[model samples]
Target: MTILKNRLFWPAAILVALLIVNAFTSNQFVTVRDGHLFGSLIDILRGSAPLVLVALGMTLVIATGGIDLSVGSVMAISGAVACLLISDLGNQNSVGSVLLIIVIAIAVSLLAGLWNGALVALVGIQPIIATLILMVAGRGIAQLITDGQIINVQSGPYATIATGFFLALPVAFLIAVAAVVLITLLTRRTALGLLLESVGGSPTASRLAGIRSRRITTMVYVVSGGFAGLAGLIYSANIKSADSISAGNLIELDAILAVVIGGTALIGGRFSIAGTVLGAVLIQALGVTVVAVGVPPEATLLFKAVVVVALCLSQSAAFREKVFGRFTSTRTEAIA
Candidate 1:
């Protein structure tokens, strides 16, 4: 009964329902071909990888009572850095060049993360405002790096990061899974998760208790930035080009939505990485469902909006109490 009452329950149920619906609507929704999983389900996992990464980072930030609106822009910047580096290399296909490019992009992202952390922690700026500064300027910075042009690179290994298969699964999906597992271990297996929740729940009280709220808050933003950068790499690899304008556009919203749907409160405190992963998967599934059910491309966003509203409402305790409370009371009375 307690498990059923958990915040994750409704979201998980909705996700399962969506999968069933997809299976019924599409004959090939789940299929195995040539010893590789090939279906709308696999497609959803592959497509959702970047969003999952972003949401994972968002989860940590939100757990610390902060938000990162600059994730999308960070994605753009990282992708631009990587693709530009690869383009400038004498041999774009050289394995060493691709490896160096990846390292440079990730390094730049970490620096951006450090900058965001400094503003929020050292300057005492609100998280939203602090991140917004980067959010607004980061894309322009990316355009400057790319010289207002899309950067194209032709490298099999680089392309494989997004499109290749590893052990019969998409590399992108594997990356997401690995991230989830790594974060889960880091948060659950140590005291970090509890300390973060303490700071988010009440900074003053945590500070009095000897918790370094400032440092914890800054770390979350840094983690968020790093995740966004990795997501950028995946996005760029998918299209074989980094278009500064289009890369990771509006992705921050999706990541936040995923975190919310995963049962994380905006006010901060408790967080569930598993729940966030499920939420990302659900969002991806919803997009795939719209197309599979023959919804017009023009109305896809509307349909998604409706579904999101329904899911959020269904998960609301007040709404559930108003609708199901009376029924539960009646059942209890009858049993008594």
Candidate 2:
């Protein structure tokens, strides 16, 4: 009963509901091709990678009671950086070329993150306003890198970063797993998670306790931006082209939604990486359900909005305490 009462329950319920619906609605959805779940399941995971990655970062940020609204822009910046660097290689040195491009992409992403950290931690700017600066300017930087045009690259290794397969799983899935594992290890295995929660629970108290809440808060944003940058690389690699306008449009919103739906309170102090991943999968599955049912993509966003509203409502304290409480009491009586 307690497990069901936990905040994670709502997302788990929705995820299961979607799976049941998908199983009945689409023949191909349950079908497995080779060793992988084909059709909508694959589509769900494929479309989910970028959102999952961003949400992973957002999980930590929200844990610190901060938000990063500039993730989409960071994605744009990183994609443009990778495309430009790879394009410049032009068959220069093969292994060295690939290493250089990947290294530059990681470096640029970290730098972008550091920029966000500095402004928020050192300058004492509001998180939203500070990231908004990058949110607006980051795409322009991407445009400058590509000269305001879509950059097309025909690199095999680069393309594989997005489209490649390893051990019958998508590379993006592996990356998402690695990120979650690392973060889980960091937070659960060390005092950092404890400090983050302490900070989010009450910044002043944490500061009084000698916790560098400001630095932790800023570090979350940097991590968020860096992950967004990595997501951008995966996205562009999947498509083999970089279009500034379409690369990461409105992705920040999706990532935020995922974090919210994952049982993370937007007000902060709590984080659930597993729940967030489940939420991302559910959101992507919702899109697949819309498409599988022959609904127009135009109406899809509206449906998603409705689902999101319901999910958020279910997360409210009143609703959870009421509905879940009643259900639990009823079950207890029956058992007695």
Candidate 3:
């Protein structure tokens, strides 16, 4: 009963059901080849890695009663910077140089994050409005970096960041997992999580309690940017090019959905890292399952939304009680 009551129960059940359906479509869906785990499941993990990073960051920002609409733009900017720099590298294959380029790209993303933080925390602007500015301008900035062209690069070391496997698993998946562990430790194993929840619950109350809410809020935005930057690199690496215009397009919406499905309320306060990870995977699984089942492209989103809505409804205790309470009452009346 306790396990059924858990918020993650429905989401997990839905994911398992999807996989079971996928297994019926093709035995290869869940099969491992030659002692190596290579299947649709693995592909979902690899493809969802970018969203996992973005959603993790989104979880942090939303936990502070804030939102980051600029993460998608940050992703674009980060990819543009990395690919533009990599394309100029004389060797284009030096592992060290690619690493440095990755660092610089992330640095730019940090600055973009700082910009959002400053606007929201320092200027007292609404989080949505503040981040929206960057959500619009950041794309232009990316375009400027790539001069409106898709910059392509050929770097074996860089390409491997997304495609390579370690221990028979994708490097991207491993990176996403590492990020989850790192953030879990950062927020849960320390006072930071409490502080963030406090601020999210009520900033004014947190201030009265002597917590530096502004600093915490600003810091989360910065972290969100950093994560988006990392995701950008992985995305560009997977494609071997940086598309300033199309990169990270509409990704912010997906990240927000992932966080919400993970049981993090949009109004803020309280978060679940593990749940977010599961939600990200579920989102990816839904996409793969829909395609595999041969759903029409035009109706794919509608079908997905219906499924997600059902899952969300399943998590609502009040809704369940309301719908089932009358039946139980009827039975009691008969007994009486």
Candidate 4:
């Protein structure tokens, strides 16, 4: 009962249900092919990797009582930077060139993160407005980098980032897992998590306690940008091209939804990386389920909206109490 009541329980249940549905709808949904995991289940994890990365970063930003609407734009810019550099290098296959391209892309993302942080932490601008500036401008910048054209690269190493297999599992999935583990260790094994919670819960109080709230806020945005950059790399790598306009189209919404469904309150405070991962997986699984069941493309978003609404309601304590108060009362009386 206690486990069932956990915030993550419902999302986990939904994921399981979706998996079952997919299994029945497609006989190959759970098969292994050529010593590699294949089918709808693997596809979900592979496809969800980028979103998972973005959600991980969003988790940190929301934990700091802030949001980064610019992540999608940042992702586009990251992809643009990498693809443009690779296209110009004339040695796309060279390991050195690939490494340099990646480094430059990450650097650009960090700078974008810094810019966002400065606006919010130093200029005292609202987070939404601050990030919005980049959200609108960053895509244009990516277009400028690509000269208003899609930048395509023919690098096997770069493509491997998304499509390659490692130990019979998708590399993208491994990257997401590694990111989650790194973030978990950084937050739980250190005092940073508590400090972030303090800042989110009460900025003034945290500052008075010498928590360096501004710095923490800035750091989180930077981290968010970095994650978005990595996600962008994965996105471009999967397609072998950088489409600035569509690289991360509306991914911010998906990331935000994942964070919220993972039990992280929008107003901030507590956060759960594990929950966020589960939420990302759940969203991807839902999409896979919809496709497997042959739901009309137009109704797909409607189904997602309904599920999101239900999940949000389930997370609402007041609503739950109102609906289940009688049952709770009866259970307590029986216990007495």
Which one is best on TM-score? 3
lDDT of 2 at 237: 87
lDDT of each: 0.91, 0.82, 0.93, 0.92
The total of clashing pairs for model 3 equals 0
TM-score of 3: 0.96
Better of 2 and 4 by lDDT: 4
lDDT of 1 at 178: 95
205-311 per-residue lDDT for model 1 (tens digits): 99999999999988988889998999999999999999999998999999999999998878989898998998999999999888888999999999999999998
- RMSD per candidate (Å) reads 1.9, 3.1, 1.6, 2.2
lDDT of 2 by residue, 274-309 (tens): 888888888888877777777777888898788888
- Candidate scoring better on TM-score of 1 and 3: 3
Lowest lDDT block of 10, candidate 3: 26-35
lDDT tens digits, residue span 1-336, model 3: 689789999999999998888788755775556655778888899999999999999999999999999999999999999999999999999999999999999999999999999999999999999999999999999999999999999999999889888888889999999999999999999999999999999999999999999999999999999999999999999999999888899999989989988999798899999989999999999999999899999999999999999988898999878877788898999999
Q: Runs in model 4 with CA error above 4 Å?
A: 326-336
Report how far off residue 9 is in candidate 2 (Å): 1.9
Q: Report the candidate with higher lDDT, 1 versus 4.
A: 4
Q: How many backbone clashes does candidate 2 have?
A: 0
Estimate the lDDT of model 1: 0.91
Q: Which scores greater on lDDT, model 1 or model 3? A: 3
